[model samples]
Target chain A: MAIIDSLKKISDTVWELPATYKEGMRVPARIIATEKLVREMDETVYQQISNVATLPGITRYALCMPDGHSGYGFPIGGVAAMDVGEGGVISPGGIGFDINCGMRLLTTNLTLDDVKPHLKEIVDLLFQRVPAGVGSHGFLKLSHSDFRDLVEQGARWCIEHDYGWNEDLELTEENGCIPGADASKISERAIERGYNQVGTLGSGNHYLEVQVARPEDVRDKDLAAKFGITIPNQIVVMFHCGSRGFGHQVATDYLQTFLKVMEPKYGIKILDRELACAPLDSPEGRDYFAAMKCGLNMSFANRQVILHRIREVFSEVFGRSAEDLGMRMVYDVAHNTAKLEKHSVDGKEKTLLVHRKGATRAFGPGHDEVAARYRDIGQPVIIGGSMETGSYLLVGTASGADTFFSTAHGSGRTMSRTKARKQWHGKQLQHDLEARGIYVRSTSWAGLAEEAGPAYKDIDEVIAATELAGISKPVARFTPIGNVKG
Target chain B: MPYQYLEDIGTADIAFEATGRNLPELFSEAADATMNVMIDNLGAIEPHDTRQIELSNDKIDMLLFDFLQDLIYFKDAERLLLRVRDAQIDKKEGKYFLKAEAAGETLDAARHHQRADVKAVTLHNFSVEKENGGWKATVLLDI
Candidate 1:
């Protein structure tokens, strides 16, 4: 593809497509990936990033993370920072369909050995209580008023309902809640979609996993200790999900609104209709931002409630209280979102709306957004890989702030889920993972097959590239023992 | 011809094209294709529960988008798995309206086997067109 020929090697871990390479690009598009990964990427990704570059108020660079893959409007691993002062625009496509779709890590004092015999029961109990699969629900009834407050208060509301500990909020992004959330902006249909799915794990790529960290996998022992992970085979719980239909509706509502007004009113032209957007200061833009906060908060509460259910299952299985078992949250990161943050642009600080579609914000040390305790160390960035491949833990670095404090979210899909399914049988893939010391529990076997390890880029290479690029510092690596996929 | 899954589409998402002799038949086929993505055995779904859905838009494309999204909303909201049994598409003044009565029972793990949970019908590569003598529309769902 011409897009491949246009890419110029910037460094060992970075590539750039200059503005001159594209017709309407206002800024260069920078990609953080190894040479091999770059070559493997499709031309559609290049076109999408350049399309983002042409948008109004986009500054610095239209950044694509290492796991970058072609997506609807922006590449899945895309990042863009737009200046409101410069008429920065907000695109629902930029924020992604699953708003605040993120990762949350919880550490426990217990190790793999402590739960060896009861592994099946623990995993089974988790799958039972969490309500996995398509169109799933439980008895988490909510009144109209309660639903409104849940979106406004986020995980705090669930904590008040005894779903989790108060400390959980502190570890979550935006303290498990965001400001400027107006439930009035949300539609009744959106509220209804989120009502029954508060604690549910929606299908496809969303899962609750139980993993163990080996001491050998710990890269920074000091940083690992600070995160309450120091021992080999230290059991940890990590969940990957989002706001379910709630977030989808929020994005849908705004995309429709933006679609109707983008060209005629905002005068923002986009190559793909999926990239519909409005100026960040417009009424439509403000409405989406506010509604997105509800989506973000809904996800925060969803994961918090899932965490609560996990703690209860562990407490019951181990015959001890959750706290007694030392089930402490490590950190929660919203890998999908657009937040207003002050970033140094050309050595001058500017408030920008940084949209991290499939990228994680890796705020370095001294940034106030990092937890007070972690302000010195840095924000914890959790990367969930394929079920068979291991995951990684990294901390933001000073050198990483170039792309508005962002890094790769996961091993971007190298192949399509359909290709994966065509290559491997779900039951056979489960057997293969089992042979490799991982347990898989999924509602749909076809879904399980779609997520086969080879379907994604190598986690080790992706993390290595991120570390080498100084975007994030590696802390630890985790291997899954049990995974619950919806 | 009713509808058929577009297997040639990308690996991660799903798409289908529905054809009908008329607008309402096309609407029914589109709904069938959308619901089939969740669970393929339409005959297995007992039509014991019925939900009425009504949507109107100035554009036929948005009307179809709204109709499909409405199915998903009900799926997530009331845990309902429905297929359109009867549908009508009409033009009042300049606005297009769709009214459909779909019948299906609540999702039961004991009965219906689950497939991919379509997050939403994405606008990416989405289109509704008039082809040959009937109407044809293609939609891609973000699964």
Candidate 2:
């Protein structure tokens, strides 16, 4: 892997490899990272991003967020908007296996002091109430017909069934349902796999955590107050998950089908087969889009059910109603998704298919998509760090418009899992986190150890890079007090 | 050969490292490792049928994903529990073409110990590279 010597340093935080660096590159590739982080990257990331640059109809720039890492076709943390009217291709790899894999932050009126007395009970209750680990199933068993409806309606299905609050939908991305999900497009095998998995947390970097708000890091006091983070030590719950097997199957089914259809039918020549795609309006592309939407809605419904379960557990433990606990959703945003959005490209508003992989939507203040309540303050971007480190809450910025309003999703892995396991022990890591007053519950000890805090880049540094690059602005930081890993 | 767990990436995810003297043996060992992750027994699968699969990809890593996905598809859709018997990979013009033969039995509760029904093979943390005098690949299957 050779470095593209033609890359020009546009700023301390931005670097660009012009289109001439590779053949068929529709646009230059812009990487948002500090010099130090850029140097630390594996050359595979550059190669992958460069391949992504070569995709047809890519608009503006093939942008890489600060946490960029090598992936199958597009680099993780990759964002690229393709002009649909100009023969753009929609690749399943661009959206990733975990469709709508995202973060949701919930605020609580209880303070750190209030939770300290019940930390053990709360963690236990969450672990018991929430089905986790590999192949875990929930109490909800959907019939084939109901499962299809669930996939089609998304969180609305949950709300209609009294599993979620009506207000929660407004705070969710796309009202927690992307329209045009064709349940009929999904395979029976996919439906079977998803039937019992709803409301369950499948394993691997998926978790539910109890965090203590650090008052010192509150940069937007007014906005924080509006989100019910008024008290300095208010406790909150944040979790990261997605559509599980349903999303995986949707991505898999499309990737294979697209590979079979695109080259023969559309004559689409891809830099990599893993990046197989078709025109957004093409039959194959439209089918994938519809199926991907099903995965997205399924995830929203999954999280909604989990939230209901959380309310139940809180009610049981505190001897108070969930309403009294103030367990209200602040916001839920999808990181891995593709949307047809309007963005200003070359001083003109153009419609493009924006694919965000391992990146969050950072719509700036006053954007109509921003919830009315937070319209003046911008969208709340929850970036989860490693279990041992603290995660940050950032607000979208106007500068993000230049990059299709995207930001890094997490701290991103620094060490390979094999290397991390050989270097650390899960039990010791658990003990170390416990010493720091962060309780952890996981099914596999080795799994816990490999995701040790040190295996990833310092989230603070990543956030600082994003802020310095003007992609997003930090609002507050939350330190982990308790965690439940699948 | 002895078996060893590579690492727990996060949550219920786990990877293992294995080795053999040649490509066929190595691929067979990899298939054994993958099946072990999903079930408890491989010896119990009767060698009643044989299947041949040929796949190609621009990269060896992608070929590995395709191979694993093929196995999972057969297992889920056709109820076939397969073991790779032989494999040949050729790299030309930056692409990998693979021809393989596998043997296994139809799924039967008395013959197989099932763990998790892996829905698909994921590209997450997937790798395949030449090592020593042979080849090695690591794939993350979405279970």
Docking class of 2: incorrect
Per-prediction TM-score, please?
0.96, 0.86
iRMS value of model 1?
Answer: 1.9
The alpha-carbon lDDT assigned to residue A465 of candidate 1 equals 86
lDDT for A473 (candidate 2): 90
Q: iRMS values in order, in angstroms? A: 1.9, 6.1
Query: What C-alpha lDDT, on a 0 to 100 scale, does residue A67 get in candidate 2?
Result: 86
Separate DockQ for every predicted complex:
0.57, 0.17
| Residue A118 accuracy (lDDT) in model 1 | 82
How do the residues B1-143 of candidate 1 rate in per-residue lDDT, one tens digit apiece? 58977654544567789999889998888888888777747678899999998889999988999999989988888888998889999999999988899999888877776767888888877888888988999887887
Tens digits of per-residue lDDT for model 2 on A233-335? Answer: 8899999888877788789888888878887898888876668788998988898999999999999999999988988988898899888889899899998
- Per-residue lDDT of candidate 1, residues A88-180 (tens digit): 999998988899999999999988898778888998999998988887775588887798999999998988999988889999999999998
Per-model chain B TM-scores are 0.95, 0.85
Q: Candidate 1, DockQ to 2 decimals? A: 0.57
